[model samples]
Target: MKSLSLIVLLSMVFSCNTSAQKKDDQLQNKTAFKVTKTDAEWKAQLTDDQYQVLRKAATERPFSSPLNNNHSKGTYVCAACKTPLYKSEHKFDSGTGWPSFDRVIEGNVAFSTDTTIGYMRNEEHCATCGGHLGHVFDDGPRATTGKRHCINGDALEFVPAKS
Candidate 1:
């Protein structure tokens, strides 16, 4: 009887995990963004690094992006859709090797819960194209929004502000 109970408990746990995975997959696949393109089109338009980070949710190497050290007045836009996402004034040095921002351009960015790392994190994405930009955390400047938008530089394109 003890062995049978253990088997039933294991089965229940597995089933619950399977269902949670299915839900997560559905969230990823079912969203309809303002801009949608075929995989081939995305491949042709973006470099390998851009495609991987934006479309496949892959992270670029730390300190590898030129934008991480950039401190110019500009707006950061989505690389895939060119939608304005972050303003230069909100950008900050989070020391995490990625382009960090304290806030996003409202309505241009979106958030979703991410559990791929075996823990829940708030993931950010471009609202226009549903491209994975990066993740957000509560640890940020207290003087500001107190939110760290740790964005992937490869997912962004800087547009200099007009003089």
Candidate 2:
């Protein structure tokens, strides 16, 4: 009888977790972004690295992106759709390997909850193309927005500000 009760409790816990996960997945997929592309179109347009990170939500190796060391005056645009996502002035070094920004360009980025790693994280993506940029965190420069927009450099293309 005790064994049966244990099994029942385990089943109930698992079912509740599965249902919650399903709801979260549905919420993530319900948004209609401004730009939509077929998978083949995206594959053809983006390099394998870009496709993996932007379309498949894969993370690039830490400190691997040249953009991490870039200190230029330009707008960081979405690699897939050229949507201006972050401004140079807003960029900062968070020592997190990825390009960290204090804030996103208003109206150009979107946010959703990510639970892929068994925990909740604030995921940011391009509002235009729905490309996954990276996760955001609350621990950032207190002087600024106090939010860290940790971005995948592979998902961005820097456009230098004109002289």
Candidate 3:
């Protein structure tokens, strides 16, 4: 009788563990997060490198961003707003010294006229918060979009999507 009771108790614990794991999985699958911040609030929340790349419109050195070699399944988010900006599947090796994505998360990033470097370039920014991300160019392989979203690695934080 004691052996039978022990088996029943173990079964109950296994069932509960499985249920908890399911709930955890559901929560982890969620990618949506609140994305609103005041200027000062954002400045305080981010570091100097994050602020420069995400706020003041700066770029990191070529192949200098850690994300340049990041080949993980995830979503890249704006360091300022936490808005989903790119998918890991869209990220690729561009040999441009920055993390390059073939595309961005929908309705998250926007393009603008950037003349800061004394040349006309497509500047990228967080669409929801107006935070600078980097630039985009037409030089990319034909396998994906002919556009490369040249992003400052400091401006982004990658969150792996649940498979």
**What is the TM-score of candidate 2?**
0.84
- Native-to-model Cα distance after best TM-score fit, residue 22 in candidate 2, in Å: 11
- When superposed on Cα atoms, how far off is each prediction in RMSD? 3.0, 3.4, 18.0
Candidate 2: pairs in clash: none
Clashing pairs in 3: 62-97, 63-97
Distance from true position, residue 71, model 1, in Å? 0.7
Q: What order do candidates take by TM-score, descending?
A: 1, 2, 3
Candidate with maximal TM-score = 1
lDDT of 2 by residue, 63-117 (tens): 9999999999999999999999999999999999999999999999877789889
Candidate 3: residue 67 lDDT (0-100): 88
TM-score of 3: 0.74
lDDT of 2 at 55: 91
Local error of candidate 1 at residue 31 (angstroms): 4.2
lDDT of each: 0.90, 0.90, 0.78
Q: Residue 130's C-alpha lDDT in candidate 3?
A: 70
User: Residue 46 in candidate 1 has what lDDT?
Assistant: 96
Off by over 4 Å in 2: 1-31
- Candidate 1 worst ten-residue window by lDDT: 18-27
Clashes of each: 0, 0, 2
- Candidate 1: deviation at residue 65, Å? 0.5
Sort the predicted structures by lDDT, highest score first.
1, 2, 3
Model 1 segments more than 4 A misplaced: 1-27
